[model samples]
Target: MKVLVTGAAGSIGRVVTPGLAERGHTVVGLDRVPQPDGEDGAWYTVDCTDPDAVAAVFDEESLDAVVHLAGHPDEASLPDSLSSHVVTTAALLDAVHEHGVTRFVYASSNHAVGRTPRTDLLTVATRPRPDTFYGVGKVAAEALLSLYADRYGLDAVACRIGSFLERPETLRQLATWLSHGDCVRMVEAALTAPAPGFTVLYGISANTRAWWDLEPGRALGFEPQDDAEAYADSVAPDAPEDVEVDCVGGPFTSTAYERPALDRSS
Candidate 1:
């Protein structure tokens, strides 16, 4: 299958591109800027908010799947993040659906449901309680997944991904961290699963401290191999003292969530 991965040079994009290549997919990596050391897949410099740029790629590539990872990972000065996350996603979805792409794997976020209490188990059934504008963008993008699938017959999956760092960087991450390998496996499942209508999968590993439900992802064929428990003892970093530690979104739920984040690579 020929696959196009937007944000292919960003933190998560760098890893996902090569993984798809290893799986025998013809991968095309697109980014806002050329990566100094991009992967072996074909690379294209693209700005997701620019419909002309996105359309240029679609006109040239006969894509089978799209792993839409292009977006600002956190809240920004309103219009920029809005145009980048929401508008960019809309453009990509239009192109994918119009071109008859078979599979679309949207990189949604845990922040979409950040305010849900921790005592209640998090599942696909949980309603989105977006804690920030960034979270709102993710929720809006997810709505596109459902629309595209229902109206255009696309097999799409929106993954409300958790902390996708290289490792469990903080104590809060012990429960939210998604291992790099496990993330690749999840995308593999999305790309290969048979007739996956439209669904939501919480992107998390098999962690002992996991608060999100894994059954939905498992049913879609995502078998996570890594666990955050391995690093719990050394999980020295933590979220801000004022931030609530009980929710699924961690720091993102705080009003002080002004930090600029990278993509949800997991």
Candidate 2:
């Protein structure tokens, strides 16, 4: 399969782009930044929000699928969030629809359900309860994907990724960490899953302390192998007890995340 990965220079992209190639997929990288050294496959420097630029790529490459990893990586004003997440997504989806691409795999975040209390395991069926504007953007993007799936028969998969890190660094991470290897595995599964129409999967490892359910991912042939439990003893001794672990969103649901919707000073 030929895959186009947006944000190919970002942290997750750096890992996923090469990892996909290793798994026998042809990877084409797209990002605003110049292609980094040692990146395997073709690379295009373009912001994903520009429909024309994005369309040109579709015109050039016979892409089988897209793993959308671009967008604002943190909380911001509502408008900025929408432009970064929703607008970028819309442009790609339009191109995907126009070019007959079969599948789209989005790097959605767990913040889409961050405000939900961590009383029970979170499933893809959980209602949207975004804890921040960043979360809201993810939810909106997911909705747009669903619309495309329903109307155009696009196979879209939204991966609500947890803490994607080298390893568990904090108490919250012990439950939420998505190992680099598992991250690649999750994306591969999303890209290759047979006819998964508008599916949602939590992007995390096989952690013993996981708060999110993995059955949905497993159903799609995503069998994550890493467990954060190995590093628990090293991280738990200094774990802080606070709002970070109180909900699926951790600190994103706390008062610290509250801010003016607009930054007029600029």
Candidate 3:
């Protein structure tokens, strides 16, 4: 299968490109920046927000599937930055429909369900209760995936991805950490799963204390091997004590809507 990965230069995409290539799939990496070392698969310079550019790439390459990973991942502080995210994702979905590409996997975030209280997280199904514009953009993308699946016959999966880091360093990471290997496996399952349509699954590993339920994803044959417990000792001491920080996915959802200002003293 030939897969087109948007935001190929991104942290997850950088690792994901190689992982897919190693699995015998051809990868076409699209990013705004050129690949510095070019060690990965074919890299194409692109801004996913541009409809013409995104469509041209799809028209040029007969993409078997699309792993949409490009977007503003953080929404807490940068409310003004999500216009690009919305435009890019909206364009990507449009291109997918135009090209008749059936398989689509969107990089939805745990932040998409950000407004849900921490206690209700375990049972509450995923809805568009976004806490920030970035999260709102993700929710929009998920809605597009659902609409496309239902109306246009496009098969899609939305992964409410937890942290793709190796370990949880901050308070929110305890509930959000998604190990590297686990992500690869989850993505692989999403790609190969049969009859997936508008499915939304959390991107957490098989941690002992997982906040979101993985039963629905289990039907997709997704069984995470890596566990966040490996980093328990290293990150446990840094855990937040109260609600302001504890287990609600941190400042990414809790922070005020203000861009990070430069420290003049620096």
Candidate 4:
């Protein structure tokens, strides 16, 4: 597969690119910053929010799939995150559809449906309850992907990712960790699925502390390999009693909206 990966320098992209290349996919790594040295891909420095920037890449590379990970990763700045998450997603979807690209792997987040009770299973069928502006943008992207897929014959997958650190480090992560290995497998499944019209899957490891159901991811052939329980003893053992655990997004729901939300690292 000739894959165009957005945000290739981000933490998750750093984990995903090598594995995709190892699987023999020709990766076109796109990001605001340059893709790191030793990464096995053609790197392009481009802002994902710019349609021309995204379209220019499509014009140059005949792509088979797009793994979109470009976004400001927090609920801090509404305008900046919205620009990257919502506007960039729209641009990418249209560009791919226009260029006849077949598959799209959208990196959605658990925060999109963050207000859902953690006790209830969060299936793709569940209603979206965005906890913050950032989550709303992801939800918007999911809807945009769906519209394009249904109307324009693009195959798309929106993965509602959980905590995506090197490893689970906090009490909340025990139930929501998305290990790097599992992240790669999830994207591969999205790209290589035999028949993917439009799907939504949670992106997380096969952990015993998992709150969201994995049935949707299973149907997409995403076999997660890691379990957060392995690091349970090493991570923070207790959550602040005042911290709400009922919603899927945890503190994101309560975070005061602030400017500069879309920092470079996010």
Local distance difference test values of all predictions, in order: 0.84, 0.94, 0.76, 0.86
Q: Which regions of candidate 3 are displaced past 4 Å?
A: 76-82, 120-126, 236-241, 244-247, 258-266
lDDT of 4 by residue, 1-266 (tens): 99998988998888788889888898889999976877655888999888998899999988888999988887646676678798998999889988998899999999999878778667778899988888888998899888988899889999999999888877778889999889999999989998788899999899898888898989989999899999998975564333446678888866454345455664
| Residues 1-266, model 2: lDDT tens digits | 99999999999999999899999999999999999986657999999889999999999999999999998799899999999999999999999999999899999999999999988888888899999999999999999999999999999999999999998988988889999999999999999889999999999999999999999999899999999999987886556567878898998988989988778886
How do the predictions measure up, each by TM-score? 0.92, 0.97, 0.89, 0.93
Candidate 3 to truth, TM: 0.89
lDDT of 1 by residue, 1-266 (tens): 89999988777887788888888889998889986462465778989898888888999999999999988877775566678778998889888877878799989999999988787568889888987778878888888788888998889999888989888867778888898899899988988888999989989899888888999899989999999999887765544353546676777777677554444447
TM-score of 2: 0.97
Q: Note the residue pairs that clash in candidate 3.
A: none
lDDT of 3: 0.76
Number of colliding residue pairs in model 3? 0
Q: Please give the RMSD to the true structure for each candidate, in Å.
A: 4.7, 1.1, 3.8, 3.4
Best prediction by lDDT: 2
Per-residue alpha-carbon lDDT of candidate 3 for residues 1-266, written as tens digits (9 for 90 to 100): 89999888889887778888888889999989898584755778998878999999998899889998887666433334455556777788899889888898888887777666677546426446776667777777777787889998888988888778867675466657788777877878888899787798888888765788887677788898776766677775545655435435446554554456322445
Candidate 1 stretches with Cα past 4 Å from truth are 237-244, 258-266
Angstrom error of the Cα, residue 225, model 1: value is 0.6
